[model samples]
Target: MPALPSFATFYPLNHHHSQGACQCGSPILSQFHERMMADISRRQFIGGAAGVMAMFAGLRAPRVLSQQPSDHNRPILLKNLRLFDGSGGPLREGVAIRIEDGRIQALLANGADSGNAEVVDCGGRVVMPGLIDAHWHTTLAGISQFEAMTADPGYVHLVAAKEAERTLMRGVTSVRDVGGPSFALKRAIDQGIVNGPRVFPAGAMISQTSGHGDFRMRHEVPRSADSPLSEQEKQGVAVIADGEAEVLRRTREQLMLGASQIKLMAGGGVASTYDPLDSTQFTERELRAAVDAAEDWGTYVAVHVYTPRGIQRSLRAGVKSIEHGQLADKESVRMMAGEGAWWSLQPFLQDEDSNVYPDAERQESQRMVAEGTVRAYEMAQHFDVKTAWGTDILFSPRNTQNQLRHLAKLTRFYDSLTTLAMATGRNGELLAMSGLRSTYQGKLGIIEPDALADLLVVDGSPEQGLDFLNDPKANLRLIMKGGRVYKNTL
Candidate 1:
């Protein structure tokens, strides 16, 4: 029989598993087994393993592509199209857009100019800004909670990468990732290693002990001052920080890690076991500390809260965005409007996309949120608050397919035009609140002169209602991001 390989060959020493390095039972291990059977010396096998590890590391690192050079001097003109422009204005016809160097060079009349530019006849389709999701969770959206907690980080990231492509195919070209370890995914997407949205990443969700983001088990709690951070925190999913000083430190840490905005758990959540839905978390001072730290970095803080008191406390702390205020009363809505805060609301009406909770209490919490969702929308509109739309799909890869369906649900409350504008234009405005820390520099969410070239060619018009959006594969004929065409069936 062939000599069995050492255990070290199966589990490489010094491998950063937390950063998603390959492990035993992965394809790499199969290769290792094959090589060992080939009777290679242990030293040679170890050297090959090291090479494989180096290759995986390179995949994680950002690379500047010579093929995708920045200087795209040659322009691409998209002609013969109707435009939505993402401004919620009437659609314009008989216009062409000039794209170059990942930005819109100008808007021109049909057959206006020809300077050796490549021409793409859009066949009179409706060209509009790509959709933006204001409250996405990049790493957590596609996997179940059990998998997210138990699976290897590398495996989880692989799942996320696959889901990212699906998300882009849905015509959602940009997303504000509110939580989870999305730094690697963002980097991969930006470097062109993966095809996905332009991610505005908030590195991790910060929560007080037993608060919304606290994912620790009961046995792991009741700790000392210097307890090792929970597995979730170590993986950059969520960190439990108490008091003002710790809150400030954690906030700054995320900012240092390239957080475009900070996300603080300002209240209890239905998903968390220990926290009640009605409970408010984080003192005003603690919330303020995070806000101050984020503001110092020229960005802002968005809080996760639903209860009236929680919303009020977050508003008082200078939070710029409220992730979920479905349970907010009229007073809270009025306060949000007065403060000019962005209300990132979702359609959580116990629909097919709703997350399934195991217990009755959590189910009740979900029901309460669903009940308040309609009222919340009414209040936001009544108060003229700056409301944005997002599908907060979490822990269910199957439900991600309903992303466009979630957007379509908005039509129940508003007109088709208003729904499209909210998902595209208004959400873009909310993303701009990230300020200087924003990853993509050019203006997004509008098809205007000099805006970033993130657009889609839709086969239907808003007059047909947003029902066409429900089936993106058949409706979205072309998709472009950063002047690069990712999908073009036409």
Candidate 2:
């Protein structure tokens, strides 16, 4: 009977031995190719099954509701509900959850446990992980004020308290505070003295003297018909370090200050007043020095880069990730991928109201910084680059909410669930956090036997249609972060 399992009969063997090599076990082209072939096959099948015609809006609602049961969370049990497990897959229905001590004890089929409990009854709402904003600016005062407070601990901590409120209320549970605003805020959040997102902070940015983060400007003041960095121009945020020795020292300094990671201005910026976006500000030695320090400190360095030369420099220097990447040419994009450095994309969508600030005032030299950002996003997508969402919020009034809404835009048509995974399981992975995998201390993003009870309940089934997330302030019925209900319309 077992004449021997054929090679084709074993899916794993076939995928590995015949298909191709991929870091992820799946065949590199399998998904794209499979979808293409399926589309063709469906077209042929549709012609034969001709009676199937179009339906009106909300056609999927009946299917969704039929599976939902009222009074589901009897003892905090999520009633009949749809589930997105955050593993880059489609949604499931009729799932029930049991939560206690802020930990998710179990995830099972609808009515899996009818035992007596104080269930909230999901009523079949959509449940997924709490959001994570990696590139949040916790210390926001305004672009005009950041430089002045670089050494002012009091001002930095004060700003942190205010932004913390803005971040958590909008559903961002965890944040990676990269560059500026200091690490004290992250520490305070961990200590519970402040109420805000869980922070993974990079104390202050490290940069070359003339680089984009460098706040220094040339002395030739007045008006410049041709020159950009006039002598009278203000200093950039980048710390001016001339040689490799100074760069190395600075990197260590950043680590000693409690940097979970490092942010280096490897190139110029589109927004910095001191340097142009295309300028190759840091040399390889300077960058390598920082990388060396980061390696020694057991952390990664995120480089703010926008030029081909600068990209190459950071890549060779072993910067762990590329931020912005707006001006990166084809070769640079390839180079970033080749090095396996992650791309932290900031999807900051600016309306005319946001970009009204003129050059040298609210300050960025370009007519608008939005163009380069959008272009970078397109290229990053084209190359299939592994990306994480970043806010780069700065001191904007919308605060961190702008970034959360931007994620809704990325999957406007379909698969918005992937964005949630990028914000959670994947983000934790990027930071080399293993035990916390798929968990908010065992409750939030992932479904497991023992996980936290931090869950979100939205109005519609996300898989059927994603417009539900389009309105963050609209139609959300329940939100439980760390088993504490901040919002519940149920």
Candidate 3:
């Protein structure tokens, strides 16, 4: 074969130089370049480029929880419990649940024989489904903004790991991770490398430039056309995309990365600085691009929006879930009911558990959201809109310890039973909107035959009040997820 062509001859010097092609100014350098190029054939170079492209395109196999053989085959019997069932129904007593293969095999009648299984006596405690937080930020809930923006990605992930275990110990066994770089944490939990809840991940919060998901500093604005993606975007914390084409591309990227659902920033947010509370972000066409991309992947889109205009735009774009609609008006609430969309509301009561913002404007915005939250709930109830509950705790490690308290705040709006059901079954139903994109395959948020075995055995009745949840270490006598006992005090 003819000698391999010189780098400058095969490609223009400027183009090759910019791409890190060999620059041989001396005879020795030229010989070294020739030897290196001869060792790596054109086929090898093309194959290497294809592998890099594949990595960037996210074409790797999805990381799902590999079933542990021991857990998969072992049968477990949980006896002597009052079943809350998570169906908004009265608790049923004297039932024992049979669990196998990470699911409830059967609900045995009183005194039924349990053969060859480990029996756990719950001592007449109230057994309920593990909690589901529909709008959680798994990786961001426990870290400060300064740390998240400036810390190493590995350190942030370690913080998230500790927080995940805390969340699980608090009796929240499943969470719909609305934003953040949680894929690694989620994989760790699934593989039993870390103890945590089931994660329904939306890889990143997709936003238009200057939108709610945009976390760039003011000085970082006026981004050059050819500038690289920001650090946060590269880390999967958030992505800033513009226009229909860019939105479509960004949404697909998340889907390719194993996002169970897509999260779009369609309106202003208190956590973000530049966007006003009343301002809408993505246009209907741009929102539709994301929706269409998610829909094609057998999943749905949930939008971060609050104002009526933003809510309406998202709904028209086929968004299935509306997150943070605390400022929604009556017409918007009615539209949500008409469209049968999910209202993923948080109890933004401006209480001790609320997110802390340094500036007065954001504080005022928080107060406004809190003021509208009660009315928003009332309207949702009146219109019979489907509602799911979450505690969007952010940026405070201390506030994360109050997860149960934030959940109990829902009792101020509804009775304890309704509140419990909202956090359990209702939120699970909302998570099911992910369809085929869901990572876990069994049922969640209910104590029924064949439901996934995520359970909490409480010492007292939650029907009267959720105060017991405020003390998980004491009152939550037993906690089980995927048929494996994580905590047992009974």
Clashing pairs in 3: none
- Top model by TM-score, which number? 1
lDDT of model 2, residue 462: 59
lDDT against the true structure, per candidate, is: 0.76, 0.55, 0.75
Tens digits of per-residue lDDT for model 2, 378-448: 77667767777765654344434444565666563225667667765566456553122212344335655
The TM-score measured for candidate 1 stands at 0.86
Instruction: Name the candidate, 1 or 2, with the larger lDDT value.
Output: 1
Candidate 3 lDDT, tens digit per residue, 366-396?
7888888889989999999999988776656
Alpha carbon deviation, residue 163, candidate 1 (Å): 1.0
Order the candidates by TM-score, highest first — what do you get?
A: 1, 3, 2
Q: Order candidates by lDDT, high to low.
A: 1, 3, 2
The sequence of per-residue lDDT tens digits that candidate 1 reaches over residues 1-490 is 3353332222211100000000111123222223333433444466665533432343342232112322356788889999999988889998999998889999999887857677878999999999999877675567764565455534655677777888988999999888755776787788887778999988768989877776666677697987887545654656789999999989998898789999988876665557777889999999999999999999999988889999999999999899878899999999999999999888878876665556786678778888888899888889999999888776667778778888888888888888899988888898888888998987889888788999999988796699888899889988888988777777
Give the Å error, residue 314, model 3: 0.9
Residue 325 lDDT (model 3): 88
Clashes of each: 0, 33, 0
